[model samples]
Target: MTREQFIKRIAPIAVQLRAEGSPIFPSVRIAQSILETGGTINPWNNLVGYKVGGGAITPYWQGKSVRKLTWEVYDGTRQDRVPADFRAYDSIEDGYRDQDLLFEKDRYRRVREAENPEEQADMLYMSGYATDPNYAVKLKMLMASYGLGRYDEEAVQLRKEWQERLQQLEQRKQALQARLQTLRQALAMTEIPEWAKEAVERAVQSRLIDTPLNGSYDFYRLLTILKRRGVI
Candidate 1:
């Protein structure tokens, strides 16, 4: 697939991972996937070229794997392309998840804590995620060239919407509290109105009103007429 098509396919997954609180940044995730397969979507769904690494098989992996010739660098020495066992998955999403799970180790702490795509790419290299000396630079180049950071910006917007929703809920709660206070204060000021005062007083004397002051604001009009007509 073309580079843009590959990015389009993985962008949603990357953004969802970020929104779901994965420590990996979305831009870095997309760039890593693009770089791993050289901007082409692989059939095995091995987006990051992640190795089997002896990790216990789980839902994200299910013991599937593939072999590919890959490059490596050791102490500034570039090795020729060598055959390696790369993890495969049922879907690109699973591959992405497994890649994140690999970062759960203490050694990948810096990668997890990286604040941006650039830092994340560098930390991935510093954490020995890849043996390529220019791994970080290559990932950064892909991110910038493809505008992969837009996915991270989209995630930021999602968080902003949630924050705004929470603010609206807090405002509603404060309004409810104010309304309750008004009701409590209303009970104290519920004396009989001037128009109904005399009529209600007589009604109270006749025990027609069990609690004369407890009548609702609208009920006072009806109560006044009933008292005047001797209905009490």
Candidate 2:
């Protein structure tokens, strides 16, 4: 697949991982996956090339695994192609989730605290997440080439927009609740007309006014109640 196609396929998974509060930046994760799998689908579906070793599989992984010839740099000098056991997944999402679990381990504690994608990549390299000496650099290069950082930026902007919308909704809710309170107080006055009293009673009976009302109510909710009771 072309780079665009590969990115398009993983973009949703990256967004999903971000939304689920994965500490790893989606862009970095995508770039790493692209590098590990060579931007192609592998039979193992091991996006991160997660290894199965040190009894990591016995108690937890009941699924299948595949032994593949992988490149490993030893003593910071030599590269060797050796067979290693990599955990296989049923789907891409499951592989991503296992990556998250791996980050939660003590070995990746520093990586989890990395402030940004570059830092996270650096931490992964320092933490021995990969044997490639240039792992971090390669991941960063891939990220830049594919414009993957935009995904992280887009996620941030979307979250900010959602927060602003929620704030506006909350303000409107408070305003509606205050209006309802004022209307209730007005109805409580001794000189309230019988028609107003009847309308208030109807609103209460319709459950528009909660008993001992103390919480905010949405404006549209109040409008719907008023319309339904013919009080609008």
Candidate 3:
């Protein structure tokens, strides 16, 4: 498959993983998967090239296994063809979830906390996640070339918008609190006017203001309170 096709197939999964609070950057994971799977139609649905060790498949792994000829770098220079056992999942989603499981390994724990895609890729290489010395470099190149970093950028944008919204809400809350304090101080006056006292009584009767009946009420608060109580 072409790079675009590969991205279209896996990008949603990458985004989903990120939304689910996966510690790994979505772009880094997508880049690594693209590199491992060769951007082809992965019928086996093994997105991350996960290997099955000599031990029996874990009880939780109900999927089949495929032995494929994989290339591994030996002596830090030479590539050797070796047949390795890889998991065969029923679907691409399963493969992606399995990839998340792989990252949970002790060696990959640090990579999960990496600050960015580059850092995560570097940590993966340093932790011997892959034998290729240029693995991190290749992943970085793919990320830059295909605009894979857009996913990270999108997440950052979402956080920024959320923060702005929260700030607005906090400002509104503060303003309301200040207004309520002013109303309380006014209501504590020794000689409240008859009209003001009547409004305060109405607000108290409607349960809009939890303050005592003798409490003061501002014009805005009085209108809102009456409107909320369906009294106006």
Candidate 4:
């Protein structure tokens, strides 16, 4: 299949990963696959930059390698190729599954705190996967360029819900704060002993207040009344 065809085929796999609660950044990984494999329909379906033979042999890519014009390694330079652990799969879903498994390994314990594709890719590096220094930067750039930052609608919706809840909490906190302030002012003015007028005055000036016991703003109005009378 063509590159676009491959992306279309694997997009649903990415979606499924999201549905299954896998926080892997599929978009970033997919972009890296594109860059590494040259496209989806290449001779070898090596998606995750896996060299051929699958071991610590030489960097010899027996299968198809992506065309790199400048470097011999990029241009099928199989001389220094090392045989690494390349998980073979029958389908794109299998490839994606391996990717998810790679992330789930104990080495990737930091995946949960990874907030972006770059961080996710970096974790992969930290876990001793790819040794490329620019792995995270390239993956991040590709994700941004292709708008692949949002791998699935489910993740996007989850983020949206969290943001909405945060907004609501902030609004409630503000409302509660205002109500508490009003209540504090009201309490300071209520049932003045006539001897504590100076104390009330000091309290009002200091603004060191607390929540109101009552739901009404009568306490604040009472304080205003006291102020007018010069009692506090």
Q: Which candidate's lDDT is highest? A: 1
User: How many clashing residue pairs are found in candidate 3?
Assistant: 1
Residue 172 in model 4: lDDT: 100
State candidate 4's TM-score. 0.50
Ordered by lDDT, highest first, the candidates read: 1, 2, 3, 4
Candidate 3 scores a C-alpha RMSD against the true structure in Å of 8.1
Best by TM-score: 1
Q: Show where candidate 2 strays beyond 4 Å.
A: 55-61, 161-232
Q: Write the per-residue lDDT of candidate 2 for residues 1-232, one digit (tens) a residue.
A: 9878888998887876776588889889999999998888776678888888663643234558998888888887755678898898877877888778778889999899998999999999999998888999999999888889999987676667777999999999999999988887554543434334454556667786654233223433454567576774
Which lDDT tens digits does candidate 1 get at residues 1-232?
Answer: 7878888888998888787778888899989887888888788999888999886886688887888888888778887878899887888889888888888999999999987889999999999989888899999998899888889999888877888999999999999999999876555547777888877777778887777776655667777888778787
* Between candidates 3 and 4, the TM-score winner: 3
lDDT of candidate 4 vs native?
0.59
TM-score for each of the candidates: 0.70, 0.68, 0.64, 0.50
Candidate 1 Cα errors over 4 Å, as ranges? 162-232
Worst 10 residues of 1 by lDDT: 183-192
What are the RMSDs of all candidates, in order? 4.6, 8.9, 8.1, 13.8
